[model samples]
Target chain A: MTLVLFVQHLANGLITGGLYALVAIGLSLIYGVLRIINFAHGEIFAVGAYVGFFLWRVLGVPLPLAFVGAMVGTAAMGVAAERLVFRPLRFADPLNSMISAIGLSFLLQNLILQVGGAEPRRLDPFMSGVLLVGPIALPLQYLFILGLAGVLIAAIEVYLRRAWNGLALRASSQDLGTAALMGVSIDRLARVTFAAASALAAAAGVLVGSVFLLQPTMGVSMAAKCFVVVILGGVGNLPGAIVGGLVLGVAESLAVAYVSTALRDVVAFVVLIVALLFRPQGLLRGA
Target chain B: MLALDRVTAVYTGRAVLHEVSLRVAPGEIVAMIGANGSGKSTTLKVITGGLRPVGGQVLLDGEPLEALAPEAVVGRGIALVPEGRRVFPRLTVVENLRIGAYSRADRNRYREDAARVFELFPVLAQRARQEAGTLSGGEQQMLAIGRALMARPRWLLLDEPSLGLAPKVIDVVWDAIQKINADGLAVLLVEQKAFAALQLAARAYVLENGRIVAEGPSATLAADPRVKQAYLSF
Candidate 1:
């Protein structure tokens, strides 16, 4: 019984961590490129999950199909947000931009609530069953999420390292005005970054929905966790988010196993504070 | 060939450039000289499409520039090496150059242009992978000009290329600017260092408090009493 409980909780934690890393990496990418925190990012994730859920429920689409749709759909939303909201506010005060983000976040959440209602929404398991390896049993869904997250991170890395558009994004992020002088459209690159980041968040949200309960207000908690992950990893650091997520996940699992189940959320926050205390910038921060 | 036709520009409803018109013919180096707040930089901003002109027009090859975006202005073969050497601090030297070709569509042509920049500034070739922010100020300035060159612009707008450089380094930078102009790229040079600018440009404009106070052949302007009194501090 003890062994089974430990494995089950570990699986849960790893799956959750995978999703957290996805969202955090997205946040970091946007920060790296735009020099803006994108406070509406988590809401974009929430929007993705809702879209995936509705697609599954109404269209009876398969999980993979719905995931793709949710990602593309949320990416479009991000692009539109960039075009309509952030772009107009580009030269405005940074604080005003942040406030606008908060406003947009709340507006998006309430809109979801209006459409989906206050009732908690959950998706029936899109994939089930466990693989028993000797004394340990692992859920296949955990492996799927982890695998997808790995691919996404790798793809982004390759793009940044080699692709033309990626090169432009990297340049623009360092100095937007100079980048413009270089003929790089800082505005268009920003729009692309926001779109890609939002899509990634949405994909993670959709995946997490299959493994956890979903609600319109779910984004607030996830958004907070994504911030913690980015902070723990160091803002604008990509690989740090992955390592930080895994560390947080394992810590959470151990706390749940050795301490108390109700203390799991407390464990994550405590880990964050302790991490910040030791290295204010983050664990992987070069400074 | 780039020309500003009675162009006026404002910031926050206050005029910064009042009907200031200037021109740089193909392969010519034209300098605009003024003290701080004399609207020298403002003229470059309007020419580069960084700021819109409220009155008249900015023309490149006889076409109105008011309809174009800044990036579109680059597409029309005008590149601004902005003041202060605003190189992307976090990007690699090579990455900075690559972005100069952002408006360009031909990848092969871009590669050739980058090679040409490397030939012009071999130091950048040596530090291609180094971050721009980490480079010495002179190196950063070189990277900035190299970045502008990567766009293969026919009209290059340079703002204060000698602002904060050692005399020897300024010579190197000025030589590179001259070399770029000699290679058939017309130049609009803005400078606070009146002597070096006057020596380099064939024609020059003197701006004072947001208006063109004088314009002539560089020799004539340098000999003018007002330019000698106000700008030449020797």
Candidate 2:
């Protein structure tokens, strides 16, 4: 591949990788606290994109406002889901929770399909422009996505590092029962973690939706990518997720350019499997 | 002050605590001494709000604690340094201390309390940036106790703090507990280490198979013929 094309693909990969990190971070946080892999996580991401699309279409809200709305609204839905479904199942077996989450995922997907139809809906970018650097071209929208992800990740990292609530969250992840005895409100922490994760997924969805068409099934692909990132990053390790995402993103982008566009998703999975085979804990660390 | 009035609890329909009653008055150290399955830890769980009592009430300052959540119960000034020295393994010593103050929103006092915890557990202060999991068992126990103290609780509920530590470490921990009580925080200590627990407590209760078999002044209970023959067999 030409150097120009490779550089172009690298930019594309980093943006996608950053988004993957955002999504995986949420998944890791929820899994950390509740110890259940939320099957509906992808659907939550999809719902976020839909929310952003609808807000832009029906309410004529600005892109920024719609993005926030989508995140907040999805987070609200996440909180409601935790309260109505997951919270009740706390005493139930972990397998039961996993099943319930899967059921919820299908339920949300069908609900969206029934209401919005199966058509791939388009959302115009709020700004359409291109920037050119030495032998490389960049889209302003891609830069926005990267910037947004950076700010959000930075904010979350700060809160997790400095806040008491963040410490409680970490403690819950380490051991739920022990955390409770230490005076952490486990239920509340679970809800908040769910909400935060949902919100991140929502934001990622909205950012990506502006660039790509939104469909009910769009989340499945990202979900697959997110899983790859999670595996590559390692379970319960946040930094690993970020690194995994970027690695997957860059690898996938390069494969699309140098190898074949059709092998784009394949590259990520292969990398993930290899990462698992070599370092099952992940590329960075383990829980 | 904390009081458990006929508190009963069950896990998965099998009862673990049956009508367990205990009390820790302000500034006093109360110990629950028993064998492995004697419901001492369950009693601590009941008081800490980790397990809701199936029957009767947990009262803090005469208010029924059954209605409050675990963290809220902490907000009401009760903290439990649970069994097994359950310090957050991945967290640094300082982070563990900060988490202890989860119920407090006052930033200024939180800093002061953290400094005080460091003062109490100087080892923790030395390893403030170290991950808690890497510490030795005795050090982890100190961190757990230090973490509980960061809450600035009126009543500190310690479940078997000296369970796995050596006698010297136990002495170090008990000294800290005694110093904590001297600083006016009431303590509810549950331990299978009957002799060490009784030495620290003002009043002590003997638990057997989920029931309190005897209750008296710490020294008297420690000297009881039954206690002497059973738990304190030295």
Best by lDDT: 2
Give the TM-score between model 2's chain B and the true chain B.
0.95
**Per-candidate interface DockQ score:** 0.56, 0.67
**Candidate 2 chain A least-lDDT 10 residues:** A177-186
Residues B1-234, candidate 1: write the lDDT tens digits: 688898889998899999988888999999999999999998888877789988989887888987776767888888888899898887788777777787787754676887888898898889989988889989988988988888788988898988898998898899999899889989889999997899999999999999898999999999888899998975
Compared with the true structure, all predictions reach lDDT values of 0.84, 0.85
Candidate 2 residues A48-134, lDDT tens each? 999998898889988789999999999999999999889989988999899999899989999889877899987777577888886
Which ranges of candidate 1 are over 4 A from the true structure?
A1-14, A31-37, A84-88, A93-100, A114-136
Q: i-RMS, every candidate?
A: 1.6, 1.5
Q: Work out the TM-score per prediction.
A: 0.90, 0.93
Give me the displacement of residue B56 in model 1, in angstroms: 3.0
Number of backbone clashes in candidate 1: 0
Highest TM-score scorer: 2
Question: How does candidate 1 fare on TM-score?
Answer: 0.90
Model 1, span A32-100: residue lDDT tens: 777677788889999999999989888899878998999999999999888877888777877877888
